[model samples]
Target: MTTKTIREIALAWKSDKQRYVKQSTYAAYVLILENHLLPSFGDYDSLSEKLVQEFVLQKLENGLSVKTVKDILIVLKMVMKFGVKNEWMNYCEWDIKYPTSETNKDLEVLTIAHHKKILDFIKENFTFRNLGIYISLTTGLRIGEICGLKWSDIDVCNETITVRRTIERIYMVEGDCKHTELVINTPKTKNSCREIPMNKELLAMVKPLKKVVNNEFYVLTNEEKPTEPRTYRNYYHRLMKRLEIPRLKYHGLRHSFATRCIESNCDYKTVSVLLGHANITTTLNLYVHPNMEQKKRCITKMLKSLRK
Candidate 1:
């Protein structure tokens, strides 16, 4: 049996893991291990429920979101399991819990008025960057996916935009994914590699440029090199300020799109597919909050059918 500390096993585990996962995923794991797990538990010979619980509470107190803390715990458990298999550390099935009564995390969304105003502005004063925001609202594209889009991915003849790649600035450390911080890679999952149809307005806006723009150029920049997410986010924030609309995170555009789909009574499965969600349940939980009117309508429909 080996007696290496958690830190030792983690180092070996990371190197081994790099071979199996995407560079972006591997980079994320490394960041978690180094920044959170290593500083807290690396020197320990064995991890315990109490100490891990304390770590969780500390992270929560330090303002990390419950989701972020849970993700960190997931990486911690992965390393522990890897160590157990190698006989470098002991194992425990830790049932970590988070306080449920913390706060209601409401999603940021554009009011219908603000949404229409932004779209109208983009149409009147056209820019490539502004087009990205319009696409997200209409198509539910994640920021990175839109940033990575190329002219060739948009098909004027077919009237579709194919999500092929996503661009992000990945956190990196020694031993892996060291080429560049800014990366362009395949979409988040197999489901993310999807094709979404453009609505008439979006199609009309882009069809004219199809022949004139270089096919290899990124849609956002209309240039060979693409703008990264951080830069794009700044641009979006400036536009929001100019228009005097309440500022929302860039992802709120996708959220707004899905919300509109749900409001239109579009099928959940169709909305999920269009959003490139790996599962339909994700689409439901995020977008399917029924109000009193919707609930009333549902009851009325059910009772009417029963009477018939």
Candidate 2:
């Protein structure tokens, strides 16, 4: 029986997996293997549940979030599974546990006033870059999706915007060298490939610009060369500073949009589809936190129903 080190198995697994996944997905797997998994377990000739659980605890103690740790574990498991299939390692099920008192922080979202303030300011001082901010607030496009958007995706006749692709920067590590490159790919999920109807205001704002821009030009830059998300995020940071608004993550725009939809009594499923969530439960868990006023109304309605 030949024993293989974790690093050997992982390298073999990556070679096999790369052909089956998207470039972005492959990049992420490589990053996790290099940065997290390989450094910790590369030379180990055998893997055990206890070792993996300790790794989980150590990652959490070092300030990595639960989600990130779990993602690492998932990659580890994939490599382990690949090893088992090739008779290079044994298989063992893991039942990892975290502190029972663990709590997730509330998601950040903009208040209605701040949300409106940003929108009004953007409309008043509109530029091609500023328009991306507006589109994110009105439609629930992620920053990557917004950056990848082209003028051709907008339809003036139908008053809709089609979400087809997304752009992201991925890091690559070669022999003693690390570099990064921008990639444009299909949306994160199949559901993200749908069309969103533009309200009259959004249509009116973008219609004239669409006529003058080349179809293949990106919306944010109005040029053939697209602006990447990092640059756009920096622009957002500066915009917030100028507006005297508190700093929120670029993703908060999507959250703010979903929150506004829920506040407006939009159906949960509709909101899920708009945000391109894979499941309705995800939408509910993230954006369905009822405020005190809503709770009070719910109680009152329950009492009223009982009395009737």
Candidate 3:
């Protein structure tokens, strides 16, 4: 067996791993490795759980979010596991911990009035770009998915839309320079490739436009070349500003859709599928908080059961 440094193992692992993952995913892994792992542990002779724990703590102290740190650790573990499998290093179990005082903050969602206001304004003055926002508000499509949507993906007769692909700009580092490229690829998970039923309102808006547009054209641009997410995001921001609505991240549209579904008593599993979540727990965790009325009803039911 031959001993190798972490950097050597990482380079080998990356070369082997690239063939199995999507380009966007491979790019992300490379970015994390170059920015976080290589700088800290590349030259280290050996890896241990204690060393990894300290790395995690240092990353957190430098103002990285817990989730971001965890992502970096995941890449680290993958490379470490690769090294062990190839007999280049020893393996050890790792159980990392974080500060308990740090809690995941509640997700931000639009209020009913704000949601309706945006919808109403779009209805009154509709544009192709505005239609993307409408689709997100109604169907909970992510920015990438919506931007990637094509006219062919919509089934007017069946009133369904297929989420087949997504587009995003990925950052690439070459030596000392950094650049970005827009990539269109299949969604990261199978669950993200889903079909959502279009409401009558959405169908009506899309029907007339679909007749004249090229099937290959993107819904947001109505051309072969689709608008990138960053550009669409800027459009969304300007619309919100002009309407005097409070600024919310583009992802808030998805949260608002899920929240409205839960508010209307939509089943948890069904909402999970509609949102194209990998599992139901994601739906529950992000959107299932009970209000005062729900809590009160639960208590009342408990008291009634006691009487029995």
lDDT (Cα, tens digit) per residue for candidate 1, span 173-227: 8865444499899999999999999999999999999979999999999999999
Segments of candidate 1 deviating more than 4 angstroms:
175-180
Each candidate's number of clashing pairs is 0, 0, 0
Provide the overall lDDT of each model, using Cα atoms, as 2-decimal numbers: 0.93, 0.92, 0.93
Clashing pairs in 3: none
| TM match of model 1 to true structure | 0.96
Can you write out model 3's per-residue Cα lDDT over 218-308, one digit (the tens) per residue? 9999888999999999999999999999999999999999999999999999999999999999888888989899999999999999999
Which run of 10 residues does model 2 get worst, by summed lDDT? 170-179
Can you write out model 2's per-residue Cα lDDT over 45-135, one digit (the tens) per residue? 7788899999999999999989899999999999999999898988889899987667979889999999999989988998999999999
Positional deviation of residue 103's Cα in model 3 after best superposition, in angstroms: 1.9
